[model samples]
Structures are given as C-alpha cells and as structure tokens.
Target chain A: SSHATGYNSNRILAPYSVYKGKAAFSLTPSLPTFTKLHSGAVVVDRRGSIMVIFMHAIGDRKYDWENRQRFALSATEVGSLLTMGPQDSCEFFHDPSIKSSNAGQVRKSLSIKPHANSNGYFMNLTVVNNLLNTKEFFSVPVTAAEFAVMKTACSFALPHIMGWDKMTHQQSTGGTVGLQS
Target chain B: SSHATGYNSNRILAPYSVYKGKAAFSLTPSLPTFTKLHSGAVVVDRRGSIMVIFMHAIGDRKYDWENRQRFALSATEVGSLLTMGPQDSCEFFHDPSIKSSNAGQVRKSLSIKPHANSNGYFMNLTVVNNLLNTKEFFSVPVTAAEFAVMKTACSFALPHIMGWDKMTHQQSTGGTVGLQS
Candidate 1:
C-alpha cells in the first residue's frame, strides 16, 4: 500500500499509465494506451489479450416462433404481443454507427457461441430477459429462414463454423473464402 | 431500502423464534447455494421463473470478438481460451459422459458454433476462437470432407427449411426436426 514516491507513467497515474517497478518487467495492456510499454520478462504475444466487443448484442435470447413466441413460455401458447427475443448462440458483430472512417466495412460481423448443450434447439426462440415488461425483443429459430441463412452461414460458411447439437456446418456464401497459407 | 430485522438467508437465524414475512411464498427448505451466475437470462418451461446458472465459466466470452476483430486481432493473443478456437469448423456431439437417466439428446448434445462473417465476400480468417492452442488453432480453409458433408446436409437435408431469407412466407416444419431440419 505504500507509495513508490514519484510516479513515471504509473505510481499515481490517472488511470492506466502502465508503469512497472524494479521487481516487475512485463506489461499486458488491455486498452490501446499501454501498447508502447515493453519492460518485462513476459514473452511477446504469449499471453492472451482481452478482446474489444463491437457487436450490437451477442447471442440474443429471442423466441424463434412467429409473433406468438414472445408472450408465453412455450411456443404453443395464447396470443402474444411483444416480439420474441434473440437466441442463446453467441454472436459478434459491429454497429454501422460505430464504424470508423478508416476500418471501411471490414468490422461488420456477428458471431454466436450459443449454449448448444440444452433443449433450446432453436436458440433464437429462447428468451433471455423475461421480455414481457421491456422493449428488448427479437427472435431466431433453428428452422426459420433467416436462421437457415445463419445455419447455412454457419455450416458452409467460409471459416466453417459449427452449429448446436450436430456435425452440421453452416455455409451460406455464394462463393469461396480466398486465403493462402 | 428497509429491512425486517429477524431471519435472513446470509445472516445467522434465531434459535427459537420463527421468522415470518409479508410475501406468501418462501423457499420451502431453502434455495441451494450456487457458485456462479450467467450474464444473460433464460425463461423456464411455462412458469415465469427463470432457470438458474451455476457453471458458466465455459461459455464466458465465446463470441466476444466482434469489436476486437476491427483491428484484425488474432486469437492466439487473447486471454482465456475459446472452446473450438479458430478451426475451419468444430464438430458437435453429446459429451457422452452422462447416461440414460436423461431423455432428450439435447441434454447431452454439444457442438461448436463456428464464426465466419465475410462481410458478404472474401472472408477473413484468424478472428475465430474454436479452441485456442489446439490443432484447431488459427482458421483453415474449408476442407473437401467438410464441404461434402455440409453440401449434403444443406441441399438434401431439409428442403422445408431452405430458400426463404429474402422472401415473405417463411419456411415451416410440422413434425419433429431430423438431422438437417
């Protein structure tokens, strides 16, 4: 708890000056600011860095059923009003608004690593928040067309993504992924 | 903001005096303590009650790579490992550890949801995290075997669930879903 006297980019630094003392020789920066420091015995690129999340929302817990899936717990229920929620499958995507003038359209992507280990066959059909009392509502069914698009996208997809519960691969692209070694 | 100074779950209960509350229903025996909780939520079968989460470390940050992908960050550098890190595709199957005590295979089923969004063309690799540091490390070109399996599964698997992304009347299925359904 004792202060190390005058600080050098660290010590009493505002938030993340990222300075180390005589005993420490390594620095792992989570933010963009600390990338310049290289003081420690830690190997370069050896430790896993924290990823910056940009998707609007990942793995929405939505109801996959028609407009009816939102209200009741089961799809086969009374008439409903709210829209179903998103799926449990994890997703990664970029917001058009968040795009920098430099990145171009490169960052627009979504990935869902859903909890495929449960009975929520159609992840999009599974509700995350109760959704009954809020404005957040979306849906994705394993059998829905968009879901099929996602399914095909996941299956025959360029990187060959996997789906819940099976060996199925999603491939919805009209062409092939071009990459060499 | 207020408290009834008597019996509380966390604190010690009195020896003889019984504690009563305004709420009619109470924990019968008492709620079992859990170690962890998920960031998201999932509704129960029919009841308004939501399912509780305990072991959530596995799927902690699965697709949490969206924003990070903007800088074209690689998976090898990230902290903590992903399930099926950067494989062309991840194979899905039941853990096979649990036995017949469970009925629906969903309880035992497991699969990887591969990540590959090409921005609609010329997909990029190295952003996926299927299983960090394993044979699946870094993305690979989709293989012939994977291609064959996906094509067969998509083309002939479920005609009922195809070709509906850009149209109106969504695809529908009546009976239970089979392999491709």
Candidate 2:
C-alpha cells in the first residue's frame, strides 16, 4: 500500500493553517504521572488508586508466590471494602455472549472471614474460567493491625477522590458513620 | 395489649361474608419446595438454582472442611461462569452507608485460571470485611471434564428459568454463541 502525503492524506486539513501548506502543530499533553504514596502488593497510591495482590496454588502445593496476581480497585470499591462484614459476599459477572472471549462467561467473587487464631484475616479469591476448564484459587492474609491501618488510609484516600465530606468528618471526629441510619 | 377478635381484627372485612359476623375463610399456600438435582459442595438443583461450597482454613491447617460454607447463585450467575475467561475477574460491592450492618462494607471478588499440569482449573475467591478486620480465602478446583458438564448443565439451567431460547438453541446445536458479534 502506498502512503498518502500529508497534503493528500486529509484534504480537510488544507485550510486554517498559519503557513501556506503546513498544518498547525497541536501539542497533546502527556497523561498524568502518579507518585507512590505507598508501594507493595496491597497499598493505596497517592492518587487513591489501590492495588491488591494474591497468589495461585495447585492441588497440594499451596505456596505459588511466583505466580502473583494484582488487581486494582476504584475509590468507591475501597469504601465498600471498609464497611463490609465477615460473612457478606459480593458477586460480579459480565454478559458472556459478547464477542470478546476474555470478557465472556467471567465471574469473580470475594468474601472474608477471621483468622482462627485471632491473629488476622484472610481475603478469599475465587476465579473461574469455563472456556478453558480452569479455576485459580488464592487466600491472602492481612493482620488485624494492618487492616485497621488500611481502613484509615482508605477512608482518607476516597475523600481525596470522591469528596465524601461527611465520611471524612466522621472519621476525623472518631464517630460512627453518621451517614448510616 | 388486648387481642382483637376475628370480627374486630379487620373492620374492613366486616362486609361480604357468608354470615353477618363471620368473615370468609381463605387458605394461604405454602412456598415451593426445592428438590435436589445434585447434592454436595457444588451442584445445580432442579429449581435451576446453583449451590457453591468452599471451606475455610486457619494458618497451616488447610483441611478445614468441617467449617464448609455454601453460597447460592441465580441461573444467570451460572451462565456467566460458563463463559468467563481464564484471566478475567469481576467485583461486587455493596454501599457501606446503609443502616444494616450485615449489608454494609462488603466486597466480594471472583476470578479463574488454569491449574498446574493442565489437570483442571482453580476458582479464586476473595472476600473482605473491613468492619471486622477479617478476610476469607478459598480456591476450589474442578477438572476439565467436570467443567464442561457444568457448563452444559448451566446453559440448560438458565434457559429453564430465564427463557433464553437463543442461548439454549445455540448450546443444543453445539454451535458457537450466535448471540456474539
């Protein structure tokens, strides 16, 4: 295929230029660069974006840290996590009939419960792939103190992005969420 | 508190009875009973509802099957699982500001990937409870043949409840999803 010259590529650009035949240079600003507020498998960045990491395991070999997986969460999702209960679980699924195989038949679920020794909690991850007959499993643990810190950091993080003033106020005052009835 | 007599319980029902003081009798039907299509950890029932079970473990003691947990899924959720890809993940979270603590601060996620040696796939489940500082993790595996059967059964199950004729037709003919672009 022959390449079209700038003049012939888009004849519509033939007018409104400072030069006779040159198109005006329009500079596109680069995307924003995010600074790290914290860095790890699970931490909230300065931009309030969160990253959660988990690992995969086979039948008897449960330690598969080499195959670490990371997922990002939005501000609202963080807020939801900060308020969820131990037994409550949520499901997310996409319409599988779409053309994109990657998005098809996808279902992801999450639930959390206490660590038996009362030391910490484990985050449960369940992944299923019907097309390939595959399922990946992971259990990531965070200590109780770590969870408290994460919750505090997350509350601050979301108000930075979502401007939930009431939430921030409640946290600052060390009061229960007044938004709840 | 004084108990109201049948005649006084509902003054609005004082009229249109077989007798002046007697109200017409009506029977309330019992709710439908569900028969088990298949029993055990994970199976679809005759009612088209699906049951998924996962066990919890504490620290190094991974075989905690005695504390097995069960979750029910609607027909549509089963269909979504049948078409999901190995890498795709979905999230479900509820609003935290709700008055009900049980329904608050909940986040659940599910994803899937292939098991080692191609024996099967592992379903990854992640559940978080920000309020209790707890999380639960579980990874369930299903062999390739089992997955295929589940997919077929799920495809049939949804159409039974959802009346998705196109989906059932495509599955019956062993045809690629005609609904896909």
DockQ for each candidate? 0.01, 0.01
Model 2 CA deviation exceeding 4 Å by range? A1-181, B1-48, B57-66, B85-101, B116-119, B160-181
lDDT of 1 by residue, B1-181 (tens): 2256544634643211111121011111111122211422111111111111111112423322232211111111110111123432332222222464432322221122343552111111222332332221112223334434333433332211221110111101111111121
lDDT of 2 by residue, B1-181 (tens): 3354554564342111011111111111111122322221111223334545455544453444565444445433453455445443333233434577566575555545676766566665566767778887666565677556555554444433332222112212321211121
TM-score of each: 0.17, 0.28
Measured against the true chain A, the candidates' chain A TM-scores are 0.20, 0.46
- What digit string (tens of lDDT, one per residue) describes model 2 on residues A1-181? 2122221221111000011111111100011112223342212223333445455544453434465544445565666767855444333333334577566665555445677765445566565767768776656565443444344434433443442432344355545644465
Question: lDDT of candidate 2?
Answer: 0.41
Top candidate by TM-score: 2
CAPRI quality of model 1: incorrect
Question: What is the C-alpha local distance difference test score of candidate 1?
Answer: 0.22
Candidate 1 chain B, run of 10 with poorest lDDT: B22-31
DockQ value of candidate 2: 0.01
